[model samples]
Target: MTTSEQLHLPAGSTGRGNYETIIDPGAREGWVHTGLRVLALAPGGSEVVTANGVEAMVVPLNGACDVAVGGEDHHLRGREDVFASATDVLYVPVGSQLTISSKDGGRFALATAVATGSHPVALIRAEDVPVEIRGGGNMTRKVRNFGTVGAFDQMDSLIACEVITPGGNWSSYPAHKHDETVDDGDHQESELEEIYYYEIQDGPSGPGFGFHQTTSSGEDKPIDVLSEVRTGDTVLVPHGWHGPCAAAPGHDMYYLNVMAGPDPVRAWNITDHPDQTWVRGTWESAGIDPRLEGEAR
Candidate 1:
C-alpha cells in the first residue's frame, strides 16, 4: 500500500471526468511513462481522441485547433497565454484516430508518452520554436524547445517543453535531479518521468499563485512536495529533488514540461543538489533577466 497520493495535483483536481485536466499512467503511484491532457473546449467544442498506446503532443494551451489524424489536416495557431508567443504544434502518431476542433474555444495541451518507437506526424510551427534562455540573475528562465532533445527531433517517448518565469523569478534552481538511470561515475543522470503543467499570471490580486518544490533525493525516491501553484496546477515528478519554480512577487509564471522514461537514449540528464552544485557556477557571471530581453528566438 503506497500513499502520498502521488505528489501535489491541485487546480480543479485533474478533471477526473475527462478533459480540462487529466494525468495519465493511471494518475499516480509512481506514475509510469508520463501523460497529461488539458482540453477545455467550449464554442463549438469537439474531441475524438484514441491515443491507444501513447505518443501525442498537441500543445497550444490557449486556443485555436483542428487536428485530424492519419489523413492529415493539422492546424493550431494557439497563443494569448503561456506568456503569448511560440505556439502551434501537433504530432499525433501511435494508434492514431484523433480529431479536435475549437471554433472559438481554447486550452489544449496533450503531451503523452509510452510508445516504444514511431515518429512522424509533424507540424511544429510558431516560427520553429526553440528559444532557450536558461538561468542567470534571479535565476532567469524562458525555454520553449517545442518537443525537446535538440529542439524537435521527431519523437517517440514524448518530452515536451514550455517554461517562462519572470516576476520575481527563480525557476528550477540548483535542486536538480533526473531520477537516475546511471552515471554514478561522476554525475550525469537519466530516468525521466516528470510533469508540471501550470499557468499563473494575474497579479493585482485577482487570482494567481506560484511556488513548487520536490524533495527526497534520498530514502530511495521517497518524495515530499511543497506546492501552492494555481491556474490549473499539476505537479508530479515520480522521483524527487525538483526545484524553485517560484515566481510570486507580482505573479507571472508558466510551466508545461512533460517528460518521459525507460530511457534508452532521448537524453536530458540532470543531477544537481550535491550541496547545491556550486549554484551552477554562478551562471557565468549572473546578468540576464531583463524580462528575458527581446524574446530571442
Candidate 2:
C-alpha cells in the first residue's frame, strides 16, 4: 500500500529525472490510467509532444502558444497567469503528433488520459468557456468548466476543469466520492480516478500554501490523504471522499482537476458524505462569499 506521503508530489520530484516534470499514468502504483505533464520553456521555445496512445489537451498556464495537431495549427490566447484570466485550450486525439511553441515562452500543462474513442481536433476558446460560481459563504469558489462532463462533451474518457478559491475560503467541500457504479433510478455514480494539481497564489511578501484531505467513504477499499500543497504540487485520489480544500489567509488557491474512469458513459456523478449533506441546505441563508467577483461573474 502506498502511503499518503507518497501521493503528495512536490514540484520537481516527478520531473522524469530531468528538467521537466511529467506524471505519466503508471508513475504511481495503482495509478495507471491518467496523465499530466508540466512543460516550461524559454523564449521562442518549442517542443513536440506525442500522444502515442492517449488523448491529450495543451493548456497554457501563462503566456500564448501555437499548437500544431493533426496537420492543423491552433493558436491559444493564453493569460498572464492562472489568477489573471481564463486561457484557451487545444484538444488532441489519440495517436496524434502535437507541436507546442511559444514566441515568449511560459509554462503549459499537457493533460491526457487513456482514450476509449477517437475524436477530431478541437480548439476551445477562453471566451467560450462557461464560468460558474459554485457553493456559497466561505465555500464560494470559481469554476471554469472548460472540459468537464456537462460543459463541453466531446472527449471519450477524460474530464478536466480549473478552480479558484479565494483567500481564507474553503472549496471542494462536504467530502464526496464517485468510486462505485450505482444506478438508483435517475441518480447514478461513476467510478473515477482523479488528480488535483495545485497552484497557490503568492502573497505580497512571500509564497503561500493550502491544505487538502481525502478519506475513505467507509468502503472496502481503504484510502487516506492529508497534505499541505503549494504551487506545482499534486495529489492523487485513487478512491476516497475528498474535500475541504482550505486556502490560507492572504493567499488565494488555484487547482486544475483531471479525471477519468472505466465507465462506458462519460459522466461526473458524485455521492456526498452522509454526515456533511446538511451543509448544502445552509448556503441559501449564509449567502455567497463576496470576494468571488469580477472574472467569474
Candidate 3:
C-alpha cells in the first residue's frame, strides 16, 4: 500500500447531517479509478439523486427511510426489518436514479460505487438470505450474499455486508492492501478496488478521531497522512498500510466499508505490511478499547 492510494477530505467537505461525504467521483480532483461516496443523513431534508455511471446500495445504520431505485420504491425501516433473517441485500444497476426521502429522518447511510458497464439494480432484504459470521475480531461481521446468491446475479457487480466492530478493539488492524490482484497460493487471480466510509461516536460535542498512513514504493517518496475524522468523514484506501486507529475519548467507532475490483470475481484478497504483519496474530492478548465505555446512543 502506498500513500498515493489514500484520499482524505478536510472538515466540511460533504453536506450537513451525520452524513460525511467521503469520495464523490463527480467531485473528485485527482486520481481516477472506480470511485465511492457515502452520505450520513440526519432528520430533515431528503437525499435524492440520479445514478449516472454508478451502482449504489442503501444501508441504514441507525434509522430507516423510504428508498426508491430505478422507478421501484421500497420502504427500509430497520436493520433486522430491512435485512430479513433469510436475505438482506439490494442491487441497483447503473443508469438508475435512486431517490431516498425520510419522513422522520433518522441516521441513514448510503454507499455508492462507480460501475464499469451496465448492471441492473435490485433491492436486498436481510430476511431473504441466511446470515452468518464468516470472521470476527474486535468487530463481528455478518455476511449477506447478494450478488452471488443465485437470485440476483449481475456481471461485475457489488458485494454488501454489515460489520460491527466493538469499541476499543482494532477492527481493520494489521492494515492490508488489495489494490492489485495476485495469487500467492490463495485462490484464483483478480483485481478489485475498495473504499472506507467511517461513522464514529462522539461525546456530547463529538469524539476524538483516528489517523491513516500509506507508504510509497520508494522510502524517499513516502507519504504520511494524519487526519482527524469524525462521524461522517471518509478515508479512501486505494492502496497502502491502511488502518483505523480509534483514540481514547468518546465512544466506539463504526465504519461501513465498500469494495469493488476490476475482476468479475467477488472475493477479499489482502496483503499486509511486512513490518506490522505480526500484529495479526496478537489480538487475543489485547482488550477492547476502554474509551468505548461511554454511553452509546
Best model per TM-score: 2
Q: Looking at model 2, which ten-residue stretch has the lowest summed lDDT?
A: 12-21
Q: What would the TM-scores of all predictions be?
A: 0.34, 0.96, 0.72
Model 1 lDDT, full chain set: 0.82
lDDT (CA) for every model shown? 0.82, 0.86, 0.53
Relative to the unseen true structure, what is the C-alpha lDDT of residue 183 in candidate 2, on a scale of 0 to 100? 97
How well is each residue in 1-297 modelled by candidate 3, as lDDT tens digits? Answer: 233234665545754554555455546543333444444455655777666767776666555677777568887755532222232345566777777776666555455556767765656675564443422345333334444325345635554444334444445556556666787776443444455555555567756465445444234434455566665666665555566445333445555566665655666667766676786565445432342322121
- In the predicted model 1, the residue pairs found to clash are none
- The regions of model 3 sitting more than 4 angstroms off are 1-6, 16-22, 26-30, 38-47, 79-89, 116-120, 127-155, 160-162, 184-190, 204-208, 217-222, 247-250, 283-297
| Order of models, best TM-score first | 2, 3, 1
Task: Give the TM-score comparing model 3 with the true structure, all chains together.
Answer: 0.72
lDDT string for model 2 (1-297, tens) is: 445787888877787522356878876678877889988878898888889778987888899999888778899989999988788999888889888899999899998888858999989999998898888888888999889988878888889999999999888888899888899898789898888999999998899999988888765777778889999998888888898799998889999999988888888999988888789897778877887655563
Q: Which is the winner by TM-score between candidate 1 and candidate 3?
A: 3
lDDT by residue (tens digit), candidate 1, 49-94: 8888888988878888888888878889898787878898888777
